[model samples]
Target: MGGSTPTFGFPRELRILSSREYRHVFDSACFKVHGKGLLALACPNDVGHVRVGLVFSKKNARRAVDRNLLKRLTRESIRLQQHRLPAVDIVVLSRRGVLELDRQTLARQLHGMWRRLEKDVKRAADAKTSA
Candidate 1:
């Protein structure tokens, strides 16, 4: 390589790794952003950056390919939008209709969800500060 290249890698530190971590977010979700075929629950974390967990259950997507595709899209969306997100652990759950959506539609939906999530977090912060 001639010049230094930008690394667009999704590192392990940015993932909600263990069952305990997932349970914490589930039990005490600070906020949720709903989108077509998906629901994202998030709780504030002290990690100083956003971390993501994806739940594409077999009940929702019967095919392994469909589940994997959704997971990849979710992870890529999070990686791109991480800097704009608050310090929170987010778990994105897929619904039954998710597999019906085409890739582009799904990507757009994920993008919108991230935008909504950012807005919601900012609003909460503002409310906290004003109180």
Candidate 2:
């Protein structure tokens, strides 16, 4: 067995902590990618690392369990694709139909959203540098 297996976890540095940080992302997201069950918003950050925030409003997902499940799925998706993500704060919002979707569908949607988020961040950064 490997003595020191490479660890993979969502560290605090990679999470959008604090109410102010969440408010900032909610109030001023530069770009977004819309999916059937989710909406991902992205904005460049000075932290120089990709940070993720999950938002599952009670209005959208009624049950507490459902909300928690959505949060888990979102975090797992980010963990898997964090390497390909850029230095931006991404907030994922769950839609009304999110609970109805199966795990595979949710994963697929998350994957697509992540890809779009990456492209949007790159495009925005390029535009800023050019201007």
lDDT of 1 by residue, 1-131 (tens): 75565445689989999999999999999899988899999999999999999999999999899899999999999888887789999999998689889989999999999899889999999999999
lDDT of 2 at 43: 80
lDDT of 2: 0.87
Residue-by-residue lDDT tens digits, candidate 2, 63-121: 89888988898899888888888998988888868888998999999999889888888
TM-score of 2: 0.89
Clashes of each: 0, 0
| Candidate 2 residue spans exceeding 4 A from truth | 1-7
Q: Model 2, clash count? A: 0
